[model samples]
Target: DFTLEELKSLRVKQRYSFRDQQYNGKFSIITFEEFISIALDAPRVVGIYPEIKNPVFINQRVKWSNGKKFEDIFVETLKKYGYEGSYLSKKWLKQPAFIQSFAPTSLTYISNQTDLPKIFLIDDTTIPTQDTNQSFWEITSDHYLDYIKEYVVGIGPWKDNLVTASNNYLQTPTDLVARAHAHNFQVHPYTFRNENQFLHFNFSEDPYNEYDYWIKKIGVDGLFTDFTGSLHRYQEWTSPFLSSEKDAYNLLDKIVAMIFKVQAHLVLFFT
Candidate 1:
């Protein structure tokens, strides 16, 4: 409803009524550039994962001067900040990012512009894709995964869809994760919260237990949680890496070796 300048005047507040309101109205709303700046200023290498929310709706309502859709401006903004490279490339690792969107067309459109990895987001089983009008089941099919894998490096589905629940208790987990992995696509499920309301009874209402089940049991590549601190602690405790300079160098050595192996293969193929 408001322009960027007008939106900045508004203060952010907790969305859920159950949460504390102490910081409400204390901080002003910020632009996407400000969000990216925070990541760039971090002490360690921090990656940004920005979502293209409701592209179809936004394009319908907003008009750009050059007749560009919302996605063009979004990619241009990232380019303006010098963010361009394929996933895990030296340039990308320095300022890593994954552009995620539920719209397959938008992702394919941007694939022509940027090589930054994209993740396809899947909604509930009852919901159809915003752009493709494909059902959740159809999209998760082996055939569909094969097609989409060309554009997206991963899929971020609603966690419940990965592991169904009945009466607030988990049911037999689905093989979607296995199928996605078979296609060499990363499986990153979303919306893991610490609150009991979001937990299944199988987790004993413990967030760590939930994390263990998804990460260790289900073997997911990544997670989207409302509590980043909790997730960080769980990951640090479960998968601690040696912080010594020698260990760091050893890790980099292996990475360089892998890169050389890949380059050697490329040379062989071209020769």
Candidate 2:
């Protein structure tokens, strides 16, 4: 069991409060370094989706002797395991991953530290940003999207933002996707599940139909699921990228060169 200090310092947590209350009181959260090893060790590629869940809270409670921030440690851990280069790079695809966060400032903070793609998570309309203290409307605005698009590759909105609900009945869809795609930002909504309680009448108790509606009609770039195998199976069945390893590697090399140049230019400007 972790001490109060230790518990307050963790960036990761058990996602569910109901099924895993035992683990909650029992196990310590894994480090980003350990998480990376888990992904890399998978026989097939498995991407990680790490969230800067509570940046303001973490920084307030966790004090390091080095004066390094939690975001710094997170990116450092990733790089220590050779997690550099942009999204879909050879190094990435082999152990593909995305770093996600609700705090836009945290994403910007780590942008200079790592080139790996980041996703901005948008919570419900009522929730204000952790760092900025702005409403959901402020960040979802065109001007904000334009600014953030430079840092993150995509935005993972709450799935309900794309669709509405009334008395447990699913309502008509929203324009969240159209707006995101207009800014050329990828969209990956979250928490697709097979359970009947979460399923809508429109989906007919079939999770595949729900996937179909989201992937085919709504057009999301990726999806997050409790069951990775289902999403993997769906993608394999419907559409698969016939990517050549050599070409992907060469492109990655070029991007790394460009990234180096960008950093060098920044140093020169600062000096």
- lDDT by residue for model 2 (96-162), tens: 6789999999999999888899999998989999899989889898889999999999999988878
| Candidate 1, 1-271: lDDT as tens digits | 6788888888999998787889999999878999999988889988999999999999999999989999999999999887989988998988899999999999999998899999999999999999879999899999999899889999999998999999999999999999999999888999999998899999898999999999999999999989999999887677656346557899999999999999999999999
| Winner by TM-score | 1
Those runs of model 1 whose alpha carbons end farther than 4 Å from true positions after fitting are 240-271
TM-score of each prediction? 0.87, 0.78
The most accurate candidate by lDDT is 1
Candidate 2 — which residues are off by over 4 angstroms?
A: 1-29, 240-271
RMSD of each: 11.7, 15.0
